[model samples]
Target: MNGVRGLLGVAVCTGLAGCAAETGYADLEAYLDAARTQATVQLEPAPTLRPVPTLSYGASALRSPFQLPVGASVADRQGAAVPGMNDPARVREPLEGFDIEQLQMVGTLSGTAGSFVLLRGGGVVYRLRIGDYLGRDQGRIVAIGDSRVDVVEVVPDGAGAWLERSRTLALKTHS
Candidate 1:
């Protein structure tokens, strides 16, 4: 019965395959159907990414990991807001009239917003990360370690600069 069913499936698929033209004409037809003026595909402009807001580290933000709300402190925590996220004192006034361009990204790490790789413009280059660096010389990262990163790449987090800075992690584990 299984052999007969398999043969039947193949016969049906072969009939269907022969019934339709294999050529891809849909895209060309859609292109031709549009008014000639607008039909020309203008490359969608690369989105203007709001420059990553500048960050600073200093004595005012001195909280230890043990003292933090989640037991992990701001130190070495990347993307940290200095005083607070929505403090009125930080900005002179609410920013309005500027459009926020939401970027479509090919995500690297699988999670919430914590650690994700961003592909800005379409077909743009990707900087390699941890798993990408295994057994390759181009993967040589100068600072930080696997345990130190929320994701693979090392970021300049200035909690204890020496702790995460200037340190090197070799690709191979030394015996």
Candidate 2:
């Protein structure tokens, strides 16, 4: 074991001595310095950004797309009254404040007077009957069927006349 140890030590010392010898590349360093000095780095110029054109909206006279058209309602009022049309002087109902689209017919109720349409809106349920107003436009409840309620809304025709438009709200069943 002593002899083997001595041989291993000698082999390690020889390996280390070989590594200690200088491996010269003095010409490579001089060449790299010369090349670096001679080389010129050219960068591309930054691209010019064009100014964005300002847009002017000229649709003050036009009706907004987000809102329902008021022309039909105006024309309806301006035009002559049609038979079975609602009276504008009648007292408005609780559900009349909300838009008809926002109101949902959830169910129906029958009473001695007549059948009533149950409308749900703004987290509250309201019972509406015939002649009850329920839309942004003076939409009066004309008829109440088993699963639908018909409302007649007065709208303006483009030709300066009022017209009656029928709108229905179907019953919504929840599972």
Best by lDDT: 2
Tens-place lDDT digits, model 2, residues 56-167: 8899889877554774564454656765346666676777688888999999999797899889989899887888788877788889999999999877655565678999
- Alpha-carbon error at 33 in model 1, in Å? 6.8
Query: Which residue pairs clash within candidate 1?
Result: none
TM-score per model over all chains: 0.17, 0.50
Q: Per-residue alpha-carbon lDDT of model 1 for 1-175, expressed as tens digits? A: 9999999999999999987965888888888777564756769899998888888766667756445456555654544432222335633211111111211223334445334233222334233343322111112222233332121223233453211212232322221
- Model 1 TM-score (2 dp): 0.17
lDDT of each: 0.38, 0.82
lDDT of 2: 0.82
